[model samples]
Target chain A: MSVLQIFRKTIMAVVCKPIAHFWFGLNLLHKERLPENGPAIIIANHNSHLDTFLLLTLFKTNLLHRLKPVAAADYFLKGGFSSWVSLRLIGILPVTRERKRGESDPLQACYRALERGDILIIFPEGSRGAPEEMSNFKTGIARIARQFPEVPVIPIYLQNAGRALPKGKRVPVPFVFTAIIGEALTYPGDRAEFMEQIRSAMAALKEEAPQLKWPEQES
Target chain B: MSFPFSLPSNTSLTAIVLIYGLLGLASLIYLFQKQRGGGSDELAARLGSWWVIITLMIVPLMLGALPFLLIMSFISFVALKEFLSITPGRMEDRPIVVAAYLTIPLQAFFIWLHAYGIFLILVPVYAFLVLAYLMTTYGKVERFLPSIGIFHWALMTTVYNLGYVSYIMFLPGGCNGTAGNAAIVLFLLIATQLNDVAQYVWGKSFGKRKILPSVSPNKTWEGFIGGWATTALFIAIVGPMMTPMQFPESLLFAALMPLVGFIGDVTMSAIKRDLGVKDTSSLIPGHGGALDRLDSLTFTAPLFFHLLVFTSYGPFAMSCS
Candidate 1:
């Protein structure tokens, strides 16, 4: 591992993991379904800042060195200290949220990372939404999956994160959240169908672990 | 300060050795049973984990007070994590969560510093108010009361109550001298754990009536009374040598241990039932989670600590060099 990766691991083990475990009571279900080797993409519903931390804690320590989360550059890499934290501490691949005409592809960094056999975590919803509800998925995940058909797209449903550390909240509320990893999917040469497949897979996961669902969803 | 290895002349080395010897014998019996095709894998795993747990518990005692306190804090952190992982609450209570996590180290630090005033009220008073204030700032009113209530209870039980175990080392020496404090902690641990095992063994062998069929089906009147009587007898016999307590006080302490421990175990069970989880998490091999192992300790520690204090056997009762 590089020195930065080592440092990141240390901080994660000592500080982040314990705090997350203590506060959110995080549980990762079906983690064995995660691909062990080669390039893979993890697509999950996003509702809290805790989405990435919850995802990171699920992987074995050794795999962490090869994992990079796809974060919005405009938010995470705003400048200075945060940029350094986004790049070094958590190893985020910043995808620009907005691009001018003739600008480079925002997902180019993600594609290069996948080419190098790194696991990329993508929030297909594109931004945080209300707790227990999902937004319409952006087609970015489909584009990447089609480009690299060999890379398995693993669908995950992050339950209760929005309630744990909802948008506009720096600290997380002490709530137990779950990361439900669904079966992996490959590109079927139809982008819309693929995105719908991923979305429905997550929706199915929400039903499977209904205990993690919000009270409103139950009603 | 001298290393704990120095073994103060008054330290109860005999009690320590006898306990481990009993554990060794139990392991041997289990092994022999396994050879006869009678032992289950779950029992074997439980015993295996017990060996690691026993060593972890004893090493810190041998290292001295600071290490013991730090280890207790770590245990509290794990227990709290398990409890929180099973509880259902809001996402907006992040501030309260941070405050609760921060309280673990702060509570341990208080014990280390022997700041009795702040240590006693930190969670029940200050933390309670701080969490309330934090919840208000979040501006999300849904399930607000229940969320704050859970947070407060988690901190109180996990951090505040468990933290009392470390304070035993700081207790004033009574008839056995300063080293007797370690013996007091060892006594509580032995009695609490023995009560748990004895209750299980007796319940399995002779139990017929359920004590609380709704909360815990496994618990029975036979087991409750049997475990209580046996553990109390053990404490009464061993108590004079290991603790500052005399025969009668030891008997009282013994009786209280299992009763409170029963409460703690069932309380966690009720929470688990409410949360719709069988076990808190599959963290430990045979044991369910850190919370499962610590359920008895949570209630016993605070009660035992207060009993010592009320009986004039705590740190406040005597002076140290």
Candidate 2:
């Protein structure tokens, strides 16, 4: 194996796996719904930066090389060690968060990755939001789903991840977070209705989160 | 007469054999129920859980103090993790949480080294001070007082409380005591678990009135009494084989242990009810989380240890006990 391949493999086994499973433990439901091979788009509610790593760790270890997390280009890819780490160590598919009319295609990389049978991980909520609270989702996920009708779109609702490592928090307090996976959906022909369907699915899944109220919530 | 792996005492060997023997009988019953076309999935799941807990406990427990301390430390880590995961804290208090977690290994190490004084006060004194200092710097002044109380309570319940049980294994004569260090631990384990089972069975069979309906609906006065009586009887019979306690001395523990265990169970139930969670997590089959399964220990282990310390062994041993 190449040196870079060995490095990534070691990092995944040693660092990535422990941080996801131990540091911020996941109580995964319907784990079998996560496929081994993919030409799939995995979408989840984004509340923390840790969401990307949590989802990435859920994939089959061997197929991990094929998993690509969709991230914003301007923010993550300033072209340095950060870019290298994001692209190689973390393996992100950079896309433009904002754009002008007829500008360079932000989603071109995602299209190519999907065509290569690589799984694309997207957060419908563009960025991290208030902990344990949901924000209005952008229609980017729907756009991706529309083009790949053959690929199954998986919805995962991660609970307490935001609280585990919320925005601006360096050290995470250990918390048992549940990852509730919803049934896979295929493109529903219309973009607007498809987004609505995904939102409804997320809402239903959120309700499924067992009435988890902490002592602080009570007070 | 001693088996291989240098088991601490013959009593530990007997305990291991008894555990497996019970497991074997349970399997037979499970098989018969399956043949009878009954859905005994919960029974089968419980058997598997018993296997996991037994292995996690017995293997390390028999090896010696170091391994036992290691396992106790691990349990502390998992219990702490389960606790922190459930209780929501401010992002600014992240440093305090990390500091809390870092104490698990140090506390475990102290017990292994028999630094009784330090082990007794590490979490209560040192860790608490460190967390307070961090919280002062990290505090946002929003919910500061309750937050301090949380960090201290979490450490005490998960870390300091269990230290007493682990410390028992390091007693000078513990390794060669009547049954061995493990016998004492095992006695505590079996007694606590039996009390739980006795209460459940009695409640189902004869319980009419609830004890604390809001905190724990299933717990009843009948169950509580039935469980205590059953456990006390078992302790009266088995305590002599495990510890230095005479039958009369064992009776005192029997009465107190079951009562304290009941307290622990309801206390945890209160936490779950407050948190609005059914169980901490489904980590252990047929039980709940590590916290759920060992909740009774949170109260019983320390109380049993202190009783043992003051009456049976240690610097404070009383002539009567």
The model with the greatest DockQ is 2
**What fnat does each of the candidate structures reach?**
0.17, 0.52
Which tens-of-lDDT digit does each residue in A96-129 have in candidate 2?
A: 8887798976787888999999999988889888
| Model 1: per-residue Cα lDDT over A90-140, one tens digit each | 889988888789998888998899989999999988889777678899998
Q: Indicate which candidate wins on lDDT.
A: 2
Please state how well chain A of candidate 2 matches the true chain A, as a TM-score: 0.92
Score residue A50 of candidate 2 by CA lDDT: 79
Query: How large is the interface RMSD of each prediction?
Result: 4.0, 2.6
Give the Å error, residue A182, model 2: 2.6
Candidate 2 residue-wise lDDT, B81-189, digit = tens: 7777666566667677778888988888887777777887899889988888888884489878767777788789889998777887787654335587778888888
Q: How accurate is candidate 2 locally (lDDT)?
A: 0.82
RMSD of each: 4.9, 3.5
Off by over 4 Å in 1: A1-26, A29-31, A73-116, A131-136, A139-152, A157-166, A169-219, B1-12, B18-52, B81-93, B98-144, B177-179, B201-209, B220-226, B281-286, B310-321
lDDT of 1 by residue, B66-156 (tens): 7888888878877776666566656555556667888999888777777877888998999899889888985899878877888888898
